[model samples]
Target: MTILFHDTISDSHFPSTSHPEHPSRVQTAWKHLDGLGLTNACKKGIASPASLEQIARVHTDGTIKRAQETCARGGGYLDADTPVEPRSLSAALWGAGTGIAAVDQVLTGNDRNAFCLIRPPGHHATRSQSMGFCLFNNIAVAAQHAIDHHELRRVLIVDWDVHHGNGTQDIFYGDDRVLFFSMHRHPFYPGSGLSSETGTGDGLGYTVNLPIDVQRTGDEILSQFKQRLDRSAQAFEPELVLISAGFDAHHRDPIGGLRIDEEHFRHFLDFVLDVGDEYAGGKVVSMLEGGYNVGVLAECVADHVQGLLQRSLKTGSLKD
Candidate 1:
């Protein structure tokens, strides 16, 4: 397993103690994993900040400049929910960079898979706007990297954050090379990802939205994921798999009302790994998105990383 992260994201600030998307979200998990020697056991490195040219793939130059100017002026809010400071811009760039590095690691055969520990959770920022506590769509940039840099025709993205990955779906909505699949809480924040919101143009039928209700059980959701993903993988025949891996659906999450727990997350990983094995030559990369309950989030991350290690061992690709 290869772990990519940035140490400087801690400088981003919301100035409100009530804000949920803080650096502690990943730090807690990193500390726990480190204490258990899990992090030390894996190959770890800091990712270089993505160049402006790389960011331009998913964001307009104006959007990039606006974010920089906002930070240059000592920071302010992009929307009612999202905030930015001097370090926030740097943090955002590194957030996207971690995902890019993860893809390179797996695709270059340096590792079977990789995980990105990032913050200011992305998947909400669009090509021209940054909102929903996200400055840029980290996963979208990484998916485009695989397509543009690696020339992969079919890439699979699985997002299980409690909220729909509206920005990601929007970016690839007209392109056929990428498949954006999301299982999120409907009638919730952002209020998108309806069953009818399929992709358009050359990308029709590539976007899969599973808007689960808060009433559904984790097992039920997991079962739906299995059936739907199996169907999609058969046709897409993805060469690479990317996960917009978010744990905010945990029952204890302040932002989400779902009842998912650690065990359920493990089950989700099982299905994701199976898909990678069957269609993607066992290559997968994951980017962190959302998870607020720090303790529960850390436990799930530990379990998730453990699963990655175990999977690599089983496939005889654990480079460490």
Candidate 2:
């Protein structure tokens, strides 16, 4: 029941007052975790800025340097949606660092599972471009960290955001060691994750994309997710699990059309916990990615983490 947070994420506020991906998103989630008694397990700290080498594991040097330079110029938009202010670079670096720190915590036996609360939601950022409020792909970086730093041969990334994690898929598409799975709304923003776009090269069939219709109920989403994840994990037998945890699929979220409620997240967590227990020894590391509605985001994450922590307690692990 260990959580790592990049406390200064709030500093990466976008320029426009009307941006949906604002700093308040993480603040609300933090407050709700505090109310749910998981915040104390949450270690408040700053992630050392992800070094160029670390970032280069997933991003090209040109893109990484350009992003740094853009943030250095004091403010701009990588796209119409992803805005950068004076504090954006440090915040993006911290977001990446949070993922790295979570991996370290899990690898060092400090925790069996760790949730990182930080964002400029990644998933849309590709190897060369930032999109959908993400500059660096946090989960991608963490997945690489597990492979490099911890020597984990197989890792699985499960993304349940309303939007596709095109960047994550793109980064590890050909690597057999990384299994990328996503369940996202089809025909949405950055719409690239179709069912046909499975893996390629040595990683063919490793990437699983379940592009559900936007009209699904919470139970339906959870059930489909559980089934696919179980089938995939049993087949791949990953040593670790990484989640691109996004709350935007909640019914109250404006961006997503799915009907996932708090109970849905609870069920999702329960299912993931069982899978972790069975395959990964209950090792699941989650990172905050997207969720715009403050109330819904907070409540959903509170429920999700409570499930994770409860499972950790059952497993007798104090760290994660």
Candidate 3:
């Protein structure tokens, strides 16, 4: 497995201490990877920013211009939750580009799977607006890149963030080629993921939402994820697997109320890898989303990365 990352991601910051989405989130996870020796254990590469055309696949020209112009003007708030820094536009482009590089690595057989540690975490940014501390939908841009560039027919995106990926769902709502599955806390922020809110038109059954209660445990979440994924894999047979991996659902996270622990995150990765092995030839690319508790975030990220490494080794995908 190869890990895709960018040092510049740490430069994306808002001038507020109260913000839950901090630069320290990615910094801590990187330090944890070094402490665990995972950094030396896998192949690593620096990520480049996505081009305008690449970003335009999932974001409108106005949205892209707005983010850039905001950054150029010394930064401001896009909304009450989303903030911009002079470096934010650059950071967001790299965030989206890192996901694309991960996809290329796996599809080209340079690596079997990859994990992108990026920030100003996406998944909440819609086609026309940035919200919820997100500036661009990184995973969505990568998914579209696979369809347009790689000519992939089926793609599976599984978002395990505590909050539903309203932006991702919105972007692919009418596209049948992508299957988006999200398991999140219902009646939560940006509340939109309802079981009844499946896809429309050609994408009617492609979008699946499993909105869980706030009090649900990792065990329960894993069981539900596995059950649904198993059924969906049989029909969709995804050519590529993507995970909107978020650790904010951890019991200690201040922003979310789920009871997920490090062990459950490992189990979640295991199930995702199993799906990849069975259907997608063990190809998976995951990107960081929301995991705010700085102390526990690193631990959860390590566990998730370790799971990916172990599965890649077992499947003989790890490079020598």
Best by lDDT: 3
TM-score of each: 0.96, 0.95, 0.97
Candidate-wise lDDT, in order: 0.85, 0.81, 0.87
Native-structure RMSD, model 1:
1.6
Clashing pairs in 2: 2-320, 110-319, 111-319, 111-320, 112-319, 113-320, 114-320, 276-282
Per-residue CA lDDT of model 3 for 21-77, tens digit only, reads 978888888888998899888778666889989999999998889888988999988
lDDT score at residue 266, model 3, on the 0-100 scale? 85
Relative to the true structure, candidate 2 reaches a TM of 0.95
lDDT at 209, model 3: 94
What TM-score quantifies how close candidate 3 is to the native fold? 0.97
Residues 1-320 of candidate 1 have per-residue lDDT tens digits of 54545464644644355678877887788898888787877778557778889989998888898888998998888889987777788888888888888888788865787778788778988888898999888999999999999999999999999999999988899888999999999889898999898899999999999999889998898898889888988989999999988999999988885878898899888789899988887898887889988998899888888888778767866344
Candidate 2: stretches off by over 4 Å: 41-46, 318-320
Estimate candidate 2's alpha-carbon lDDT, on a 0 to 1 scale. 0.81
Error of 2 at 271 (Å): 1.4
